[model samples]
Target: MIKTTRIPKLYVYQKVIIVFAALIIPVYFVNLLMNMKGQSFIKQEFSDSIQSKAQFYSNQLDDQISFIRNQQLQVVNDSDLQKLNFLSGTLDVFEEIQLVNRVKERLSTIQNSSDYLLNTGVYMKSFGRTISTQSGINKLPNQEYEIIGKLYSNSNKSSIYYQGGRLFFIEAANNSSVIVYLELSVKKLEKTLDQLVGNYGYSGAFITNEDFSYYISSKHDDSIVRKIQDNVSVEQSNKNDDSHILKFGDQSYRITYNHISTLGLSLYSYMNQNELTGSLKTFNIWLLVMSLVSVVIIIVFSFSVKLMIHNPLKELIAAFRTLETDNLDILIRPKNDIEFGYLYRSFDKMIDKLRQSIRQNYEQKMALQHSELKQLQSQIKPHFLYNGFFNIYMMCKAKDYETVATLAQKLGSYYQFVTRSGADEVPFDMEYRHAMDYVEIQRIRFSNRIHVVAGEIPDACKHLMVPRLILQPIIENTFEHAFENERKGGNIHITVTYEKKSLYICVEDDGNKLTDERLQALQKKLANCSIVLEKTGIINVCRRIQLEYGKPSGVFVSRSEHGGLKAEVIIHFNYGGGSDV
Candidate 1:
C-alpha cells in the first residue's frame, strides 16, 4: 500500500480570521514609517536650533571685534598719537609727557567702549617707545613686545591674527613706524561661551583658533578639551557653520560650529543628543501604546465577526467538500439569521431531490441494459439455430453422417452456452469455450474449402468477465459474407490477446470479399454511440460490448493483414483475483 500525505485542513472561518489578522500589519508598517519620518524631522530641527545658537554667539563676537578695530583705526589717524610716535626721541620730558597724556585719554575712550576689551596700547619702533593706557610712557619688557614687534612685520593694514595664546588686532601707522595692539578679555569671552551652550544639560561651547593651536571653553576641563581635540576636526568649520552629531566617551552630542572671520577662529558648541530629542521619545512611547491597543481591538473584533459571519459560511463550504466525496447525507440546521437559515433549508431539500433522481436513473439504466443483452442473445439463437438445422438437413439429403454428427454436436454445445444459467457477463475462459464451439461448427460446414487459425485465451486474461456471445456474431458474419459466392483460398484467423487493461477478440479471414471502402463504412458505424440496432451482426456485437464496458470497448472493423475484413471486439476490465463479477 502506498502512503499518502494528508494536508492539514483549515475551515472557512479560520482562513477568514487569518485574512482579518493580515489587515492589521499595515497599521504597524505605518507606525514604523511615522517613527522614521519623525526621527529625521526631530534631528533636523534640533540641528537647526543649536546652529542658531552658534550663529548668535558668533555674530556678537564679530561685532565686538569690529568695533575695537574701528577704534584703533581712529586712534592711528590722530595728530597727537602721530607726533608722539614720530618725535618721541627728540622731545623734552615735560612736553612729551603732556602729549602722551593726551594720547592716553584718546586710548582710554576707545578701551571703555566694550566690556570684552581688556586693554589697548601702541608701540613705536622708530623712537624705541611704548605708549600708555595700561602702562603709560614706559618701555615694556621684550617678551611683551614680541607679539606687537613680530606681528607688525607682516601687516600694515588693520588685520586680526591669533598668537601667543591670545587674540589681537594689529595695524601699522602709515610711514610712522608705529604699531597698535588690542587684547580681548578672557573672562568675558568665557561668559559668551556659557551663553552659547544655553541651559542644555551635558553641554559646552568653545572657541579655537584657525590653527587649532589653542582654545578657550566654557568648562576649562583639560581632559574634555583634549578629547574634543583628538576626536573632532574643526578644519571645515571655517567654510560653513553647519551642525553635526558626534560621540565622545559614552555620550552622543549634537555639535555646532561656525568660523569667526573677524577673529580668525572657529566657535564650537555641543549638547547631548538625548537631551535635545527627549520630547520625541515621549511622543513615540505614547504612539506605540495607542497603536498596540488598536491592534488588540482589531483582533477581538475579528473573532466576533468570525462568530457572526464566518461560522455560517463555514458550514456551507464544508457541505460542498462532503459532496466531493459523494456523500450527500450531510445535514445543516437552520440556526442562524433568516438569510442563512433559508440557504441551509434549501441545501437540505436539494440533497433529497438529488438522491431520488440518482436512484431512479440508475435502476432504469440497469433494467434497460439487461433487457438489451437478453434480446441480443435471443436474436442470435434463432438465426443460428435456423442455419444449423438447414445445414443438417442438406447433409441428411447428401447422407454425410459423420460431418452432420460433428456439426450437430457443436451446434448443441453453442446453444447450451447461450442458455447458461448465470449473469449475462461471464469469465473469459467460459466465453472463449463458447466461441470455439461456434467456430468448430462453421469449420465443419466449410470442410476443406476453409481453414480457421485460432488459439486459446492467455492464462492471465482467462478470468476477466465479459458480455456473453460477443464473439459469435462477428465469426458468423465473416462466414455469411466473406466466404459467400464460394470464394476460394478461404482462410479464417481468430486471435485473443490482452494489453493494458483490455481484451481483444480479433477474427480475420483471407476471403477478400469486403472492400476497403466497405470496411471504412463499417468502422464508423461500429464507433457510433447509438448502439441499439435491429441486427445480430458485427455492429450488434460492438454495441453489446460498449453497453457492457462503456468507453474504449467496441468492435473495430478494418481490412485484415490477410486481405479480408478483421472484426476486433475489444472489452476493458480490471485485473483482480477471479475477475470482476
Candidate 2:
C-alpha cells in the first residue's frame, strides 16, 4: 500500500442510535401527553355545542307534534265531522262509508300533517272504519278494533298509548263522537336520528315497548341495539340509572334511554367514543409531525451548540461596535458550516431583538414628549381666565356700574364652575351652562358682532354625563377662528341631540369660509399633538379623545353648509357614566 494510512474505526462505529433514542423517548412521551390533553378539551367543547343544538331541535319537534294533535282535535270539534257522524235518516251503509272517506281525505290534506314524525289517522267506531293517511281506509284488525273501542270509551280525555311496533293516540272532541288515532312512524324517527348524528357526530338508536321488539339504529350494529335494550330493561328492573356507557371489544358507546310517558315508547341517544373524539383527529396528526421534527432539531442543535454560540457573540459584538459609531448598515452573515449556520440564525435573532428595543425606546420618547406638549397646551385655559379678568377690568373703568356688576357676577360664576371641579365628568345640564357662560363672556368682548344661538337641551339628556368644558372649547374656537374676520351678523349655532346609544353635539358657525389648506393644516396639527384638540378646550381635545376613548371616539371637523367651520364632538356613555375625553 502507498503510504498505508488507516481511518479511525472509532468514529464510524460510535453509538449515535443510542444517543438519538435517549433524546427522542422523553420528547415522544411529552408530545403524547399534550396531544391527549388538547384532544380532551376540543372533544368537550364540541360535545357541549352539539348537545345544545340537539336539545333545541328536539324541543321544536315536540312543539310541532303538539300543534298537529291540537289541530286534529279542533277538526273533530267542528261541524263537518259531527254532521257526518250524527245523521238520523235511513242511510245506505256503503254511501255513508264513502262520505266518511271523503271527510278523511279532506282532513289529511291539511298542511304540515305529513311533517310530523308520525302517521296520523282517523278511526270511527260507529262505522267500523279506520282511515289512515299511511294505509288508507280499511276494516281495523280485531286487536286494533278492540283498542279503538277502548279509546272511544275513554274519549273524555285524550289517550296516548303504544301497541304493535308503533305509538298510538286517540282524542275525541266533546262536540263530536269521532275517534282519531295517531301512529308514530319508525322511518321518520330514523330520519330524526340521522339528523342528530349528522349535527353532533354521534350515533343514536331507539326502541319501543318493554320487550324491545321494534328497534331503530344509527350506524351501530343491530346486535348492539339489542344488547343495549336488554341492559336497559335490566337496569329499569333493578331501578338503577337509565343512562350509561358500554364498552364492547375496542369500541365504546354511550346510551341514554327515556321512557316517553305519553306514548310508552323508549327514546334513546347512542354516542360512539370515536365520534366524540372526531375533532381531535387533526390535532393528533399535527402533534405527531411536530414530535418527529423536534427530535431531528434537538440532535442538530446539540451538535452545533459550542461553535454556534461563540461565533455569533463575536459577530454581534463587532456589529454593536459599528452601531456605536452610528453605522447601522453592518452585515453579520456567518459561514455555511453547521456551527456557522446556527451562528447566522443567532445573529439574525439578535438583530431583530435590537430593532425591537430601538422601536420601543423611540415610542417611549414620543410618549414623553406628547405628555409635555399636553401640559403646555392645558396652560391655555389660564390665558382664557386672564382674558376674562381683563374684560372685567375694562368694564369697571368705563364707569358703567350696571354693566360691571352683571359682568362681574357672570365672571364669578364661570370661574367658580371652572375652578371648583372635582371630577372631570359633569352633568350635561352643567356642561351646557358652562358653555353658555364662556359664550356670554366672548359676547361681551366681541359685542354685537358675534351672536350665539343654542337650541334647547332635551330634559332626557340633561342628566347624561359629559366631559367638563367639552362644548365651551368648540364654541370658543368658532368665535376665535371663524368670526375673527366677520364685521357683523356672525352667528354660532349649537345643537344637542340624543341618539339611541350615543349623544351628539353639533357646533356650526356662519362667519368665514374654511379653506381646504386650513382644514389640512388643522388635521396635521391635531394628528401630531400628544393630546387631541377635541379632548382639551382648544388645543388637546382630539388627543385626549384618542387617549381616553381611542381613535373610534374622537373629534371630527368639517365645513358647515353655512360656509363656516363645524366642529363635532362625540361622547359615548360608559358604565361608570360618560368616559373622559
Each candidate's lDDT (Cα)? 0.76, 0.65
Estimate the TM-score of every prediction.
0.44, 0.41
lDDT of 1 by residue, 1-581 (tens): 99999999976667777776687677677877888799889888878878987898799788988888788888888888788777877999999889878888888888899888877888777657676566666665555576667766655444766565566777777664777778777778888899778787678888886555778776744655566566455536344537766777787877677878777777877788888887788777877897888778777877877877687887788897998899987888898567879888978987886798597764665576677677766675566678789889998899998888988888888888876666877787887888888888877666657788887678878887777777877888888888856746488898999877778888998886687778777777777845435555676677666655666777888778888888888777642111343
Give the alpha carbon lDDT tens digit for every residue of 1-581 in model 2: 57977985432113344465677888788879878887877766655545554555556655666666676667667555566666613467776766776667656764346564355666555555666666666775655556666655654454655444455567765443467666666566667767766754446655456677665544456767766766875668753454566876688776655555434455666678787886678887888798778778766755554345544555666777887886656566766666656656655675675677587764674464355344533545676678777877887888767866767777887777766626555788998987787777778877657878887898778887665666776787888787766676588888998776567889998766679899777766665656434434544665554444445555677778888888888766542224333
For candidate 1, give the lDDT: 0.76
User: Residue 329 of candidate 2: its Cα lDDT?
Assistant: 60
Clashing pairs in 1: none
Specify the poorest-scoring 10-residue window by lDDT in model 2: 9-18
